[model samples]
Target: MHGFCMLNCFLSRPDEVTFTAQFDRPGNIGRVHIGKAEIEGYKSKVGSVITSRDFITNSKGGPTWRLKFEICTFPLKGKVRFAFSDSTADARDFDDAIITQQETVRATPEGHENMPENLNNLAIVLLQRFKRTGNLSDIDAAISAFKQAIHLTDEDGLFMPLYLNNLGNAFLARYDRTGDTNDIMASISAYRESKCFDHTSNPFYIQTAIFCYSRPATDYDGYPDDRLVAAQYWVGLSQQHDPSQVLAAYSTAISLVSQVASLSQTIQARYRSLLKVSRLSTSAATVALGLERIDLALEWLERGRGLVWNQLNDLRTPIQVMKPSGADYPPANITEELERVSKALDRAGASRELWLAPSAGTSFTDVRALPGFEGFLKPLIHADMIDHLPASGHVVIINVHEDRCDALALRRGVHELCRISLPDFSYTKAEGLRESLKLYLHASGARTRGDWNATRGMRREGGSGGVVKNILRDLWILVVKPILNPGLCGESKSLTLPEFAISSYIPTFQTLVDRVKKPRKVEPENAGIFMISQPGTPNQSPIPKPERNAAATVNRVINIMENYTCVHFACHANQNTSDALKSGFALYDGQLDLSSIIQKQLVGAELAFLSACQTSTGDESLAEEAVHLAAGMLAAGYRSVVATMWSIQDQYGPKVAEGFYASLIDSESEGLNADGASRALHYAIQNLRKSLGDSESSLVSWVPYVHFGV
Candidate 1:
């Protein structure tokens, strides 16, 4: 008796045929024939017949016969007939037949119209095999096939990039095996050539390029700079795709930025490194916001913005002394080691070895394991930020992207987050406003002393001042008004202020008189005023300068900060665009920079009124980072800060200060309300606006005043 089955299959490339057969009798034989051509090397037609005894026993204790045949030795095309036969079968089973393509059969009939595509496909198959088997011959064949395809295809054809990209893959795969620098360079050259294709004309080609580039960009073991370059390439290529794809590319690039500017480097080095990817976070958040993923946008902002400042906060976290009851504290020695590493990390030039220390590795993990510390030293998620919101007021974070502008407001006691869209505001408008304000400042010389004397002539000329007025009005209508909508921030009257007395300590400014008088004079030890002023100027009062050195000036200010409840500055502030840490307030002889103040870490500081030029103006390149003097004050332990977004008019400074102080000090309670700093600034700016025509024209004088923190 005999049993047989036949299947006709088409051959597109070189392939293999495999099947398993089962026989019950010892003398039963199985044979495979392709179009009457029997396979050799197993049981040759001229030799002995293979019986069931020669087959291996399967799991079911039945004899099993497995056969494999390579199609490369046969014809390249056409239907091939496959037949299976079992001899002397009581019952024979033939199962699990599979045809696996091993490689691409070279384009047949020599001058085919689809020859280039066939060669390209052939190269891809070879390249894939090379990757799997690490075979040099297969990669070489792939590279050769790819070059042939490229030579045959038109230069402007869509398939050209595909061929070049495959060639690059072939070269890159070869480089992995041989470690040859030439091969790697060749791979890069191929990829560069592929990118020369016009993305607009063929978006599919661009997407293919993105896929090819993303592989190396996200490779975990790749060099940071190399990965960054690939990631940037991926970002550029992804722009042709949809916004969601573009956002994914930006997400990848932003993540790679941390590797480039890691904490193992010195703070200065990290900042310098980050300058390469300046505004990257804002761009990513903008993309995320465009997709209406407000939570994702916030998360990206929190991850990428203020990175250095956040690192400092983490390093200086007082985890060593934190021994909460019922919590599993780390051993005393572990805590001590963590303290040592934290201090070392905070130093100016922390070495990489400090980061690699064993204690540094395990310290944060152990600390985070303790109760109420799970989020310690980690980037705060949206939920974590909401949980830490102040008890009474809303925290509105505004993000300005080119696609859209939005404000995310987290109100106290509200579990749901509110998103307010500002349709009129855009990144382009903001940039334009910034440029116009800058031009007005430069044309009118409205900096340093905050004097508006130079601006009077320009205002009369009606060029710069009118432009600034319109800019401010636009800011109000487009950005501020939308955010201040009652639905988001609630009514102004509903805001509550934390009770505190500024009469405890006050830093007297140059223009201030007895406008902020103490309700009742206290003992000298309990109440005091410290003044810092530059000499050789008008209204330079009896305030004495202890030392003229910049360091001495910083030390004096820091000492006052340690003792004072509130400090006010009516001096010139210079914002360092290159190094934000160097941005500071100009004092008697020199400048007291932000870095100096932050290093001191003052305690019991209540409020800081920075009534100076550009106190809140951050570096444009580091827009997401709060690297201005106002932010420095907050980081240095001030509960509230009143700062100027631009240069304030010297004449109106005193009036604004008077209004701010008056609004903060309650006559009935005889105390200063620190939490009302935001409200007080609004009150002062409104007063200034009223005095200066109470219209768009007044915006120039009043708009610069801004309040930061509660």
Candidate 2:
């Protein structure tokens, strides 16, 4: 064929033959000829039909000359020859060739061996053409062809899965064009069926599965559970030697995590959901870094980490304080609607009504449409997070993945991030360290207050001590040192100002300045600690107990907490691995769990000093979330928190507490500045390190002490 042409023929006897030919060039005449003789590289006399009429324009705005012809003396049960000629000299379109082949094969008798394969090829070409032409008919025809091919394919055949995958893609394309839910459902069913076959031996099959799973996984409007399952499937398929697919899988999984652990769910429900996809952000960042996309790595880390904490923070943000450009105050109706919705959500969460919060949260859409509220309750972007960084010091976030480890530092006065690579540290090493520490604590009789034995001194000895020493040393050398090195971080600067030199002024001005700068001793009444009695002890309550119930005790504690600027808990803490919301500090009457602490929402709370065991240690299953007592305090409105990572020595806890408080409350300061809480904890830990020999052996006491927030 000189120009694009497709032919189909059916023959019953030697004397009768019929076929059709299609031409694509305008005003191009074509002829179809057939011969009954069996000829190979030889000429034969044949009957011919000519098409000399004007061309008809097809739906795609191209001239088409379709003609049917009958030939005499076409032999049956023998070789038959056909030829086509056109007036134009243009090359045939590849798509037209595929169509021609498909038509020829389909015209054969029923039960043709290669019918399914040819149909699949034809459908794929049609889908491609539809993509280029934006023609609904082409896609509809492609879907029909794919379904027919799949129906004809044998269930156990090698190409069945391939045909089903093609069908799924066609449905997805149709869904994008038509917005039909049935098409999406059909697509998911097709993809799921495609995965039934064993694809382990062939990388191509596995990649095809990955490609199929990615459609539903990244669809934002799809069902959340289905998307999660698809993303999990993508993750499983992408694990074998495809770094790009791994990154893409994790990126989708991480995005879906927020939907799974949605704010509409209760805190406990959110944590339970988050446990399923822990460490996704870390793994994603590792893959992105491997591909040299540092920006995406950081974005993924920020978006996925501390999801629950970020949600609570967003909820607590004051709506009235958000001033849109040219607006003096937010509209009263919007504020009222938000308050109503917030109360309903709170009630639903409190009652554990799973179905109510989603309805309540829907009202927020109207509020979000208001000026200055477009991003209300949405996940924060990296730029917004950078704007919230402190004016001094760097917030260092370290991520540990199986493939690699690194620290991303968001420093003051710099928009770009500082990335510090930690080649020696790894996920396996970190897990080993955690396991070793757990075993050491269990062996040393320090898991809880009841487990500790005073007679067995808390000193490092032999192999267990060696393990603890190695753990701390490895953390410093492999993780901390690399990020804190001078070449990477430069020199650290003091955030506070120093006292002025008296000699820089004249005698008269010096005396006036001294009076102005004189430090006034803070009265005890202005700032004080609110401490509760140790659990199981018969000490009097700081405030009167209304009743002996858990609710009464919590209310009493809340009342006392409201009057104070800071609170200190120096008791045992229990970490419930199965349900982190139940993890809490042991109180005199009952346990003060994280659920209670967050629900109270204490106001004017500045600092929380949790000198209890394992206050900052989160559940290993939910590592990415800050589901611990310290984080609970922060979510409950505390600006700063001082927590221990593990169990502390019975005597050392008091020493660290005393040193921390001594530095925190300056003799001349007017109030307890929570801004200095981090510095205070650092000073306390350094003193403890020096007092206990300042070596790897003494790390158990000092390394556990940690500070969160400014």
Number of the top-ranking candidate, with TM-score as the measure:
2
For 319-374, candidate 2 gives per-residue lDDT tens digits of: 42343322434666656555555544433254344334444465567667777678
Q: Candidate 1, residues 160-254: lDDT per residue as tens digits? A: 88888888888888998999999999999999999887346676766678888888888875556567778888877677564446876777788
Best by lDDT: 2
lDDT of 1: 0.58
RMSD of each: 20.6, 21.7
Show model 2 residue runs off by greater than 4 Å.
1-154, 157-196, 200-211, 235-249, 318-329, 450-453, 463-465, 486-527, 538-553, 667-670, 695-697
Count of clashes, each model: 0, 0
**Residue pairs that clash (backbone atoms under 3 angstroms), model 2:** none
lDDT scores for all predictions? 0.58, 0.60
